[model samples]
Target: MRLAIGLAAAAWAVIGSAASAQDYRPTFHPDQLKGPPAGAFNEVLVLGSPHLSDLPDSFRAEQLQPLLTRLEAWRPTAVAVENLSGLQCDFMRRYPSRYAESVEAFCYDPSAAGRALGMDVPTANAEVERLLEAWPKAPTAADRRRLAALFLAAGEPGSASVQWLRLPAAERVAGDSLTAEMAAALDRRMTRKNEVDLVAAVLAARLGHERLWAVDDHTADSATPPDEEEAQAKAIMAAWDNPYVQARKDADQRLYADLEHPDGVLNIYRDYNTPDTQMVVYRSDFGATHVEPSPQAFGRRYLGYWETRNLRMVANMRDVLGRYPGTRMLTIVGASHKGYYEAYLNQMHDVRLVSSDEVLR
Candidate 1:
């Protein structure tokens, strides 16, 4: 009987070893694994993309191809987008007129600004130009009014004559001031516009899945700038006891320290919003709280508001998962979001995390 029991144990050990060996594949490709079951929605792929304007042709050929192959293999039911802000959605459904108003208000008026810049304005795209030429000779009254406001804001008069006017002394001074501010604002807007386009194109090409879900929360405001380094340090120190946050800080420090730039530390600092002044405070605070040495305090804080916002985002993703049941999802978001997203999603019983490196490569 004892001999029979020993043999049984040996058989179990051998089986375990074989299973482990089968699971451990050294290759980097996603094709190394089989797709999830047809009725099972168990996997998710998250990607990080540089702004639309920054994506080069090389990125499409090199990075995007592998990602496409993985998505095709997985055959997700839907592709989610980061666009579709609240304002955009509102315009889509209830407020069609307001939506049209907003679009006209937002776009740059080429005719007025082009003439002021001493350039002959070319028509817009063929479709737009064709519509404009065939139209009631002018834009709709609302569109015309909106364009006039935009033109005035851009330091070009909506009236053709005012566009060419040599401004009177006082008006010229005000115009100069407005022109400087408008140019700066325009530059910033243009930068963001290009980035958005780049991200959209890459996602569209790679996923090709219809029913794109826009999961972003438009209400969340931009991150506040840390007033000083020390303030930022204190915020980082505050999270020291949390193992996950500590691991992230350690990784960021090692990455930044290796850089040659004096401002290298600033990358981690800015990422965390840690001010230098708060560093000593965090150091002292963390030391008092623990007996052992700890990772360097990076001086960034994730406040209560940020935590709530992230929780909502996770809930949104879960809701989408529930609705689609078995469909794979690809989430593209900022790098700072990587930790929170992974932590929340990893806890779910049905979810499998696919690394960006696996997909991108």
Candidate 2:
């Protein structure tokens, strides 16, 4: 009887060990790993609007709703957004001024303004607020308080408003000043532009799925012009006197051109001025250039940091896919990033790219 009991116990230990090992392995299915259907793609939607006005009035009902519907239909298992470190979100809620400044920097940035205008609204904050409000259950008061604190520290008053109203006026004011200084410092960094896209992308992705992947680098650097390139680009522009170039230059001076209305012109100019940092234009050789320029660049640079970032992002995406095995992914990005990201991601095995027009249609 003792011998039989010992043998049974040893067998149970072996079975338990096997179960534990299997449990650690991710159990995603191979059949579920397919991309979007032919002629349809899993999307990484990109936008250029920096403010509310940038989105069309139909965006919610037209663009976003349809996309959400499709995503639900497709049933992706994971979503990602560019969010602050968990600690940062906590910090924002605890500190209002920092949160406000961060929010301000995000919403009031040149790109943010462009996004708003693209959506035909005054600010992107409206859309975000709308999203939060529409959701039956959102973050708790505690969460808001934490986010507000971060916004205050970040120097974004508008962002702070979402949570800081609960705080005393004196505290709010002090926080605002500090947040502003922090935001200014961040503005000087090159990461701000890319960070916005990364954040928005992550947010939208999170709303779509439980498992969220953040695929962006968070490093910050000052914007220093490449001296040789700057000189060369200046020389090139100085020498250009083509009629087309001259015509464009002339058109720029007029608030509205004869062919376009004032509102239309404003929209275009605003979008052009706040081009996405990751936007790329492909040359014949497949070499890339920044397709959009910051307001400071006067529309000269067409491609910027997007190429490097996209490569890394795509790799991260692939890693997620590998881990999940068959899970579908929806990417959100700046409009300028849409074209290139689509082109490249489509080349990956078993991956698809969806267009905004197609999704909205």
Candidate 3:
């Protein structure tokens, strides 16, 4: 085994040496440049979470209390989640052929309130900004309800949920241009148990934050041509059928099955954020896919798309931190994205990466 490992290392060294010989290789690193000497570093906590909607049926809202407590202790000044922005969805709506599916699956259509209030996504997005800028120190239920309606029209249910979750149950009903249908949708949204709703939005509301940022991006996802769809799926699935992936599945089943415990959700999160899980995820997913022997290079295509999506997501988070510099930001993303999020965000000059283990502990 040592002989095999030595041979692999030698081969990698040769490859690395050859790559180093290339004068075109970039010498500068972004992380090396940083900071206003006087200001606090922009701290970011990347929380890897399960898609709460996929949690076992036995799961309950109270199961999240401990996790919330830990995160609240961190006290993020800004919260971002893995959901596409309403404006992006609206832009994609113009080009259905490329983004129709992504829009349908991820974007909320706020046409009802949009029509009633004469606010399209762009218009409502602008209104949302205007309202928040002048948002009062102590906002009424009517204030929250109006903002919730604006969020809906902006195609941002995640942000809408921040407003929705803040309002008392009695104040959660329709009013202030939040039509009955949109109001009911917000009700359904708060109960959906998705990461954005149950976790990000809830935390944001508790922190007295007026809004949560939707930083997910699907701009790079293109529809696979009908003829090539099967080939792509076949190639990706072929890569996925590996031992590491199997082990991941087995562990997931055990974790989900154990959700009756008070700390079940936290345990699942710890499992996802563990250092060991990082290599497991890469080996099971991207690393495994990287070596697939597909004639169509479908695996690389899939990998490219994944990396691009994550990059854009990080860019969106950076955009938020740029707007509110030096503030701590909490980003709630999927388990698979934890490693990529850290790897990319670590390159930003002004950002300080916080350990998930530290926060989770």
Number of the top candidate by TM-score?
3
- Looking at model 2, residue 105 earns an lDDT score of 39
| Candidate with maximal lDDT | 3
The CA lDDT at 180 in model 3 is 89
lDDT (CA) per prediction: 0.43, 0.40, 0.89
| Model 2 TM-score, all chains together | 0.37
Candidate 3 stretches with Cα past 4 Å from truth are: 1-25
Model 3 poorest 10 in a row by lDDT? 30-39
Candidate 1 lands at a TM-score of 0.38
What lDDT tens digits, residue by residue, belong to model 2 across residues 1-361? 9999999999999999999998886676543565554444433433322222343332221223323454455444555433332323333434544355443333333233223234322233344345445543445444444444343333232333424333333343323223444334432331223323323333333343212344432222113346556754554454342354444345434433321342442343234323232232222112322222234542233224445556655666666665555555655443344455555565566565444443333
TM-score for each of the candidates: 0.38, 0.37, 0.92
Model 1: per-residue Cα lDDT over 191-247, one tens digit each: 243323233333443443212445554333333444545654555455454655555
Question: Which should have the higher TM-score, number 1 or number 3?
Answer: 3
RMSD of 1: 17.5
Task: Point out where model 2 deviates above 4 Å.
Answer: 1-213, 217-306
Q: In candidate 1, where is summed lDDT lowest over 10 consecutive residues?
A: 157-166
